[model samples]
Target: MNEETIKNIEDEKFRRLTGVKRSPFEKMLDILREAARLKKAKGGGKNTLILEDRLLRALEYIREYPYLFPYKSKRWGQ
Candidate 1:
């Protein structure tokens, strides 16, 4: 299946488990944070590399949806 199909499946599973709906961007952030925690805890394992790769992908997604995440930029005088 494609990425959207996989995401939909995960979304349904998350909703059923938590009884709360979350946007895909929120889900990506949640997953990325968990991966980061796990990577640190696992330390030096190959799984850490995998988690890092996933984290980068999630970061790219965030970059694509900058409006979903607000940052203080010097250029913006924030």
Candidate 2:
């Protein structure tokens, strides 16, 4: 989910959805932002997804498929 969508969610529900509380999520976002800035300084192309969206997608993947992470899938012949 994006920032606007997340802002409308209740704290408890959001925690349930992402498995993280709002404050910790914001802190994680800040860390991601700093890492992105550092990466940009090293001269890479712009990311297709913004930091917030990327964080959300990561959290979703972790919550949905904890066992599969690092993400080894049959599609990759792993």
Candidate 3:
């Protein structure tokens, strides 16, 4: 519901799935990267918006399905 509650749940599930903790920076990056990818897919002169919608859903799924969350390419909080 609320952002903080969602964040706590997200963190818990993320750690449970990946066996590691996620940081604020990583979360922000994930949100930003996912946004950029979807925007480009939509505005880059393509008509297949289904792919864009699927990418958006995949990003949302990444938020819920923590195991699918990729490891941060850079170490966070280290």
lDDT of 1 at 62: 56
Candidate 2 lDDT, 1-78, residue by residue in tens: 568998899999988888899999999999988988888899978788877889888887789987785456665776
Which regions of candidate 1 are displaced past 4 Å?
1-22, 44-78
In Å, residue 48's CA in model 2 sits off its true spot by 1.5
Candidate 3 stretches greater than 4 Å from native: 1-22, 44-78
Clashes of each: 0, 0, 0
> Whole-model Cα lDDT per candidate?
0.55, 0.85, 0.53
Q: Which of the predicted structures, 2 or 3, would earn the higher lDDT when compared with the native?
A: 2
Cα deviation of 18, candidate 2, in Å: 0.5
Q: Weakest 10 consecutive residues, lDDT, candidate 1?
A: 47-56
| Cα lDDT for residue 35, candidate 3 | 78
**Cα lDDT for residue 8, model 3?**
59
**What is candidate 2's CA lDDT for residue 30?**
92
In model 1, which residue pairs have backbone atoms overlapping below 3 Å?
Answer: none
Quote model 2's TM-score. Answer: 0.79
Q: Residues 22-65, candidate 3, lDDT per residue (tens digit)? A: 66435655776687788987786644444324433445566676
For lDDT, the strongest prediction is: 2
After TM-score superposition, what is the CA distance of residue 12 in candidate 2 from its true location, in Å?
1.4
